[model samples]
Target chain A: MNPLLRVEKLEVVYGRAITSIQGISLEAHKGEIVALLGTNGAGKSTTLRAISGFLGLDDARVTEGAIHFKDNSLANRPPYLITKLGIVLVPERDKVFPNLSVVENLSAPVATAGANRKRLEEMAFTFFPKLAELRGRTAGLLSGGERQMLALASALVCGPELLLVDELSLGLAPVVVEDLAQRLVEIRDKLGITILLVEQNATVALSIADRGYVLENGRVVLDGDAARLKSHGDIQEFYLGGAGERRSYRDVKQYRRSRRWYG
Target chain B: MQLAINIAVLTAIYALIACGYVLIYRVSRVLNLAHGELMMLSAYLLITTASLFSKTPFIALGAAIFLSLCVGVLVYLFLMRRMTGEMVLAAVLTTVALGVLLRGLVVLIWSAQQQNPAQALGWVNHSLPVFGGRISAAGAALIATTALVYVGLFLFLRFSRYGIRMRAAGQNPLLAAQRGISLHVIYALAWGLSTLTGALAGILISLDSGLDSTMVLIGLKAFPAALVGGLDSLVGALLGSLIIAAAEVLMIYYVDALLSDVVPFLVLILMLVFRPWGLFGTREELDRV
Candidate 1:
């Protein structure tokens, strides 16, 4: 089957001296979740922003690249046009209109997208029942988890075919992260929509992703099945802690000692 | 009793002009400082059109409104569209330039003379009894016009889909675009409505007094109306105008005549000191970068 989305040699240069991402290529198939795992300062979010057309063309220029969304070229299109073409990006920083209520936030995409306003709203509410209960509450009053849920609901309200979720688990509690991850899996399973999740949380991303790519210093260092990558020696040593040996209560103390020595 | 009627008439006129200023400012977030100039120009246009046509008063009024809408749209497309971003100061200054240009253009066309169109429009008549004293026909017409404009604005904003979209665009342009509402179309509509309001206010003012270049200064009165009402609130504009007008009238009668001019400035200063967001504006709007 043809890939739902394709990025060919995507190079994003921040300035004259700083190259954020260099020669990165990836493909995401329909009805699958592809996680882009990376450390801090990795080009994961940069790649996502470039695809969504949020970053400035002149400053953080896409020096050499082409992005294909369902066979349509999206390299030079404006952000709104890209959204119209059925690709929605839930930005990293949860850019919700602070003063507007939850209902207004959900209704905003309807006003802009102009299709499936009713059905998509119902679908969003189903995925996030908490949102349905607090539809009248202003977005400013929502907690961190609720805000993330609202952001996700707002993006889904647009009824995007391909959802590019950036930093879904960022700055949330562990329990909240797990809940979000479960919801993402349930969404993919039930809705048959494609997802490209860019995240810094290696474990949580790999836990839900069908396939994962490890980005280091703006280049893809590893790409394989999620299950295999989870068990990979280097991944276990650095990211997952160890294979078949979870960090126990006593092991946590020893790990802290090693971490301090390494530091 | 005569003083009371005079104060009521003045309050109604001030409220009408304030409403128009607030409407345009709410949607576009740009202070059309030339708004007063637009009012003056439309009044002049109405006078010229009435003299040239010698037609029915209703037809002449229709022609004036049509002309003002056209001028408003032209201003948006030619001037306002070119001014964007943090250069709101530049945008305001450009409007000031437009005001000067408008005043100069009117002077050249009409020879800088004050002309009365109320006689031609058949508004000149004997005074009608109000509480215990009498009010002139023109003063009554101004109040009637204000009521008509208010009801029209209320229905347009509350029921019309485009009107709702315009309000949405004003509140958040990016979000509005996400739902396929073009900011340009909304801006044009806002300009059209704003011009319509200004023209109507100008006609009403001309009926009360004669039309002159100094009529443009009436727009300045709207600045205080906007400030007192809260720049973003239509209701605020109406209330603010009433307060300012009543205060001005009362000050002229009871305090000092000069206080009528100074009152709006005093209200503005007080608002700036305590509630810089005006009466209805949010903190976010005031802190917008």
Candidate 2:
């Protein structure tokens, strides 16, 4: 069966000369949680931006590449058009409208054509019960975790078939991140929605993701099933931080040298 | 009692015009300095249409109002569209330049002479007594129109889906755009609504008094009401209009008559000095402006 979303050799460039990401390809089948893992400046966000149609705002564009959603080309389209096509991105920052009440934030997004808005809103409340309690509260006043929940819930109200999440655990406590991770799995399993999660925290991302890709310097350097990636030697050394060895300081230096050689 | 009536009349006039300022400024963060000139241009449209459709006064008035709304949309599509993504100061200056161009165009088309639409339409301007205070027919109509416009606007912004999107756009335009809300459509709608309200003010004022370049000053004066209330808040505009109008009317009665022209600005300055966001405006609005 064909993948739900396919991005073939996508290349994103900032302004005209600065290439942020090049030859990046990935896929997510329906009902799959695909984690795009990367450290800072790994171009994970840029990939998501390209897919979600937000690159235009930053003078960025897909200089070379194609993004297909449900077999439809979404190359260089406006963000709203991409959104209407069932892809929604919950941005890392300014995730919620600060001044709007929680209810208003949910109501603000233009749901997909033929979407049952009332049911979607009810589903959002069910996924994030904390949001229901703060329905009347201004989004800016909510706690960090609550704000993230609101952002996720609002995105859900858009009736997205593919949800692109950027840095889901950016500033949240581990416990909060864990709960959010569980909810993400629940969302994918219960709603049958595909998720492309871009995260720096590999442990959290792999814990829920069905498959994962590790991006470094705008390239997908490693990709495999979540369990395979979790047990990979390179991932174990660098990401999971020494899988089973108490290495010496000399050994740590050797590992850094090896990373540079491989990178 | 007489003073109260004067204040009410003046407040109605200011509120009607001030909302135009709030609507545009709130949505785009650009102060439309050309509003006064646009209002006068509409009133002049009334004059041209009044003669064309002299027999049907309502048709002439409606045609002029409709034309004014079109002009606003055109302004956004042609003029302001280019200024999008440019500096806010550039957009504001564009309006200033637009105001100058419109002022010149109005004079060239209609001439500088003051023309009365009431006379052109063969309508009589009669002084009517209300609550022991005298008001012209146009003044009463202005008061009623202002109330209806405010209530309608309040409901539209609060309950309408488009209104929610507009507010959403105002707060975070990128997010709004990402959520499938068209920024251009929202901005254009805002400009259209603003000009409609401003045109209503101009049409009524010209119907009551006369239409000329001086009518632009009325539009300019009402801007302070919008500012004093908050550039983004409609409720603030209404309350600001009342405050500015009361101050102007009282100053004219108890102080110098010439002070009427300056009182609104004086009150505006005081409000700006203490609270740049106005009474009901979100505090971040000041930073955005």
Candidate 3:
């Protein structure tokens, strides 16, 4: 019944004048997937970085409020300590140690957490059978989809109670995203691991997420059940670029152009 | 046969110093350019302590090692920690200054005089026939001590938890910290171990010839050894040391004696050109720089 993770008024600032996230509050309950949807510069990744403690205190700090994981205050905790507390973040960059083999990459998180190494490997393999086959290969050689799988698998190997995934469907083919979405559902159902997924792909995320929060300009603009948010006119207007007409060709073209400019 | 014995003795000494350099560099990724100076400091400490305790050479040696470890820890906490920044040049310069300071301090303490502790140990300078040549007691001890140190380090690295943590810290400090391995503790341990090896090698070399400020230059020989062996590979250090020592000795005999001074540097350059990662280091390691 209790929430697995809670973030209350979490505000992050980049510099003296630049505020990334103004005031964001969110929660993830036990055995539920919560997707954080936002446009570019919506402070989604920054929020995750702040919660995970990867951002150094000087360069990036939570200017106000607190983040609690399973009732423990994680506002000022170091990144390693946060990891030790069982909230594992699979960062957006797929920051796998390239020289290390897939097995080594998987083992690193587990080893750092001091988990049961054998059980971790077994559980990771169960979720990603492809990883088991490519265990000997270096993570550098893996495809984007495969790398995402490895990244997810590596985090799960820690046996984390809550998994914070940043942009899981980023840069993947449509079919690959579908495959990952299915796996995410199966993982939640089978392992009972809570997930907080930050995504730019609203449709894919909403399809799997139990509940969703639509963020715009660092503030939560909409929050409700996934089905309700998908049908909400405002949500469709902001994220999908329109309510009906299946997203105009001109709009899609403009979106792609903007993506290239930003990217 | 005399030639073989000399080569073996020289190889063992080179290997000992190379191990010290490699250990520090592998973990810290800093060249520790003043490492040779640390060795010089330890040798002077041993010489001074030996003079005071004229009746106990072994006691003096033990005390010297302990003192060197303390000095190493002190250097890490006070000097190395403060030298951290984006510019490695600043760190390298700091080490250079420390080396100069150590060398000057040695001169102030011991003067420019060359001192020998062989008499303090009451070991007569006599050579026994081995491999159709005479092998002195000092040569035998040097080889024996080198072998003991190498084997001890091997066992410690393979079996000890601290040693494993040290290796892990070297490979990935962030990952090591995530696992609760303290970086400060590992760095101190690394410096202590390296200083011990360096000091022991310096003392042994001093015994072979005599202790003087110039003995510090012997630490430079380790640079080539580390390069050839792969900065991260202990076995590479040994192999590289042997190769450098053999080349130097052979050059002194067959080539011009004057060219021996340049052999190690030449070998380092050639190795860098052919295998920049050294013989044992991974290519990925080069990308880190």
Candidate 4:
């Protein structure tokens, strides 16, 4: 089966000077949950932005390589057109229209051309029932977890074939992150939609993701089954807090340095 | 009694024009300082159209309004479109320049003399008595048009799909685009609507008092009303217009006749000093402006 999204040697540059995403390649097959793991400025979000439409940085652009969604090339396309092509993004921040009511937020997205907006909105409410109850409440007044749920639901309301979530676990409790991660799995399984999740937390990401890629300094250094990545020494040491703390700082630094050298 | 009628008519005029300011600002966060000039231009269009459709006055009026809408869209496509990704200050200054250019263009095209659409259309600005006060037919129409426009806008922004999308675009444009809402279309729609309403104000005011370059001053005066109400809030604009209109008219009655032109700005200064966001506007919106 063909992958729903394919990024080949993608490179993003910011302000025409800084290279945010050096050559990077990744893919997400239909109905699979893929996690993009990285530290701050690892180009995880930049890669996601390139795939969805364009970088947030005003002068930033996909300077090299291409992104293919189905048969369509997503380069330089407007965000709304990208969305109409069925790739919806849940941005890292400012995801929901703060002043809008929960219902207004749900109803506002421009779903795929042929998709039934009513059904999508209902689907959103079903996935996040808490949103249905808070239909009249302002989005800004919602708690962080609630806001994340609304953000996801609204993205779903767009009837996306591929959902790109940036920093799904950012500023949220571990329990909440885990719960949302499970929801991501259910959404994929039930809707048969592909999900490319960009996250800093590897544990929650790997817990539900079918496959994962580790990006550092704009390069994809590791791509494998989620379980395999969980056991990888570098991932375990830097991402999962390591097996035991007694091992020490000198060895960990050497391990990181060696990993960077190989990368 | 005449004082109340005068205040109501002035409030309606200011309210109608103020929404034009609010509509454009709420969507793009750019103040179209050229709004007054655009309004005056629309009234002038009525003069040309009146002659074009000499036998049918209503057709001339309709054609003029339609032309105003097109001019608005054309302005966005040709001028404001370039400034979309640029700084807000740049866009505003461009509007300032556009205003000056348009003022010159209006004078060159329509000339600086007082032109009468009412006479051109073979119509009369009849003064009718109401509540023991008399109001010109055009004044009554202004109030009615203002009411209709606000109600239409309120309904459009609340429940309609495009309206919701427009609101979504206004609150967070990036998120709106991510949600598949086109910011360009929304911004263009705003400019079109803003100018449409401005046209109504200009056309009606010209019909009431005849038209000339001085109509721009009415457009400028309405700015304080929009500022006082809150630039982004329709409700704010409505209340703000009432406040500014009341102060301007009452000052003319109780204070000095010379204060009519200065009262709106005087009230504006106080509102700015006390509540910069206006009565109904969002506080953070001021920072963006």
Considering only chain B, report the TM-score of each candidate against the true chain B.
0.93, 0.98, 0.94, 0.98
Best first by DockQ, ranked: 4, 2, 1, 3
Q: Tens digits of per-residue lDDT for model 1 on B54-96?
A: 6588788889889999999899889887653234567777888
- The reply for model 4, stretches above 4 Å from the true place, is A55-57, A248-253, A256-263
Q: Candidate 1 DockQ category?
A: incorrect
lDDT of 4 by residue, A2-47 (tens): 7878888888888889999888888899888999998998989888
For model 4, residues B1-289, the per-residue Cα lDDT tens digits are 9999999999999999999999999888888899999999999999999999989999999999999999999999899887765577888998999999999999999899989999999999999999999999999999999999999999999999889998888888878888998877888899999999999999999999999999999999999999998899899999999999999888888989999999999999998889888888888766764
lDDT of 1 at A260: 9
Off by over 4 Å in 1: A11-24, A54-64, A110-114, A215-225, A232-263, B1-4, B48-53, B82-87, B120-126, B133-168, B175-181, B287-289
* lDDT (C-alpha) at residue A186 in model 4: 90
lDDT, candidate 3, equals: 0.79
Highest TM-score against the true fold, candidate: 4
- Ranking 1 against 2 by lDDT, winner: 2
lDDT of 1 by residue, A1-263 (tens): 88999988888877657889887888899998999987887789888877876423235667787899887998756566777788878777735656667877776564235565788889899999999899889888999899999888888877788888989988999999999999988888988878999988888999999998887778777778899888877677766767555666766555421110100
lDDT per residue for candidate 3 within A103-217, as digits (tens), equals 7676555343556768877988998999889988977799999999988887776677788889988899999999999998998999898899999999889999999987777
The residue pairs found clashing in candidate 1 are A111-B179, A112-B178, A112-B179, A112-B180, A113-B179, B229-B236
Distance from true location, Cα of B11 in model 1, Å: 3.5
Q: Is candidate 2 or candidate 3 better by TM-score?
A: 2
Q: Each prediction's Cα lDDT score?
A: 0.78, 0.89, 0.79, 0.90
TM-score of each: 0.82, 0.93, 0.77, 0.97
True contacts kept of each: 0.13, 0.59, 0.08, 0.79
Alpha carbon lDDT at A71, candidate 4: 97
